[model samples]
Target: MAIKPRSIFEEVSETQKPVAAPGGIDAKGRGARGAIRVWLMMLFALVVVMITVGGLTRLTDSGLSITEWAPLSGSVPPLNAAQWEAEFEAYKQIPEYTEQNAGMSMAEFKVIYWWEWGHRQLGRFIGLVWGLGFAYFLVRRQIPTGWTGRLVFIGALGGLQGAIGWWMVHSGLQEGMLDVASYRLATHLGLAFVILGFIAWYTFSLGRREADLMQARRAGDAGLVTLSGVLVGFALVQILLGALVAGIDAGRNFPNWPLMTTGTGASFFPPDPFSLTPIWRNFFEDAGLVQFVHRMSGYLLMAFAVFVWWRARRSPNTQTRFGFNAMLALMVVQMVIGILTVLYSAPVQIAIVHQLTAVVLWIAILRARFLARYPIAQSIRG
Candidate 1:
């Protein structure tokens, strides 16, 4: 056989070309990420409303108005005068009514009843949204890989929160109790924040592609991540402490700032801070102690947040720095709102704003932490 002359473009060796990643489950799953994020965002808004309604319920002393946790039947409010009276009678049997709201009129009872009913109804709606959304995504095979369990976990928490809400109400129904136990209230509120935190984190993660996140993580600032994580822990503890403050009406007791005092004396501690028998009970029951702890925790949280923000100033990423800056600014705003809430004796409007601000700050800190761990890339001009 005659050999043909070698062409100028002849290959010296076989070189494999890069192949595009195949279309598969993960690719299809990613395609639906935007939709899933929107669903999650809806859940986020509903949960925020739920938390606000829950706060208003507690503030208005309406949590015990239903006096029962009839999850299925409770979705519907009384439609007639007779049914309303029956519902009022049930509430009358609870300790909250006999001890604090004796002789409350039917109209007043209706107001409180509606407050609680609306709270529960919103909860039911949230469950429906999550259930339907999750089911639709599941049936369509749109859920991202490794996300089914996470979504399920949120639903599971929501269900448990419902039970805990009833448990809290049950505490007030017990003989001689004026309100739900502060610790249990703390548990309930704490779990809400945890659920909110997870939803927020998942939302942040879904904002970027999985591969992009992995690559960005390689360039992340580990120290800033750790610092921000500590800040988140501090913020969470402050939140639980705030729940304690709300649980026992502690916020109204200390109307002064820079120093917490009671009606009794010039002492920094409220009267009978440790008067509770078990001593441990003081931490949860004593208004002075609870608010004091909340105040101190707030200070510590702010200090730590400042440090985290300061450290984040050195981050190479512009978005990451801006996130930390916003977090620090919100922390300041929240601090002011909190002081105003206390100074105003926790009025319904200001107190609710304070609580909502905490929610905002919690999410901001989480966003900062996320950025620290998986910073967004910037263009040369940025």
Candidate 2:
């Protein structure tokens, strides 16, 4: 007699035993998303701190003290007096030492060396954190599908940033060069903003499940979407201009409000603006012209932020409106910090605060844009 074929339904019901509850995604999926999002947020905070530290290093005239990349060996730093003297002697050979800080003592040299070293050390730590966490999640199969490439892209950019940092520092070491090239500084900072923006967007995307994001798309406002995008692009340009200003020490040139002019003969425009050769080079190298552009850009950024805020107020989504409101507030505060930074001649304390405020503004804009793209659903009664 032929063996009776077991009933398919009976076999499935008895042996299959739920096979992951019918959906391709399971509860583990949500846990993984949450874990990854938290990890990204931590990285985001680290980067923000790193940016602030980088600014401080620049402000303190410490960026050029290291004079070497030495990515792996440099992490240990100088442990003995002889080692410290060796490091200081090496630093004395650079343009910044001979030209800008000729009389600096070994004690002072140590001060700057630590700043640059700390900045690099923090970067190394960030890389370690990202690498280890990513590998762990990937091995455990916790990273959600379709996200491996995006995650990998962030690490790649981060590694590129390290190289860019070294490149920025090298520009200062060349003969006759007192500081990093303004354009290279701008490039390094611009890439930082790009990385931060991507992290913010990714963090936002991960906050909600895939299904939730799909469902919320219908409710997203087109006007808000366009306006938010415009604001983000506008903010990035302003950041670049700000970087140009900082790179050239433009903020210390005029130290006036409402324009580049101050005191009795104060005028909004810089006097004798065509001092730089190549004509076009004045925009980046000339302190007077660079600050002039930065001031005007500030005005434009403020006006544009207002326009976006005005449109956002009319959005039906409460969260979206509140987000815009917060962004507008940050824009105002950031403007104040920028002005204060200028008036104080870009003092180390004030300048660092100004940079941190910029980071806050940058995050605020990203969050507002995220809300525009994936607005929170309000109750029908509200």
Best by lDDT: 1
RMSD of each: 3.3, 4.5
- What TM-score against the true fold does each predicted structure earn? 0.93, 0.91
Tens-digit lDDT string for candidate 2 (58-91): 8887888888889899999999999998999898
Look at candidate 1 and give me any clashing residue pairs.
Answer: none
- Candidate 1 lDDT over 275-323, as tens digits, reads 8898898898888888888988888888888888889999889999999
C-alpha lDDT values of all predictions: 0.90, 0.88
Question: What residue runs in model 1 are displaced by over 4 Å at the alpha carbon?
Answer: 1-31, 263-265
Q: Candidate 2, residue 41: CA error in Å?
A: 1.4
Error of 2 at 164 (Å): 0.4
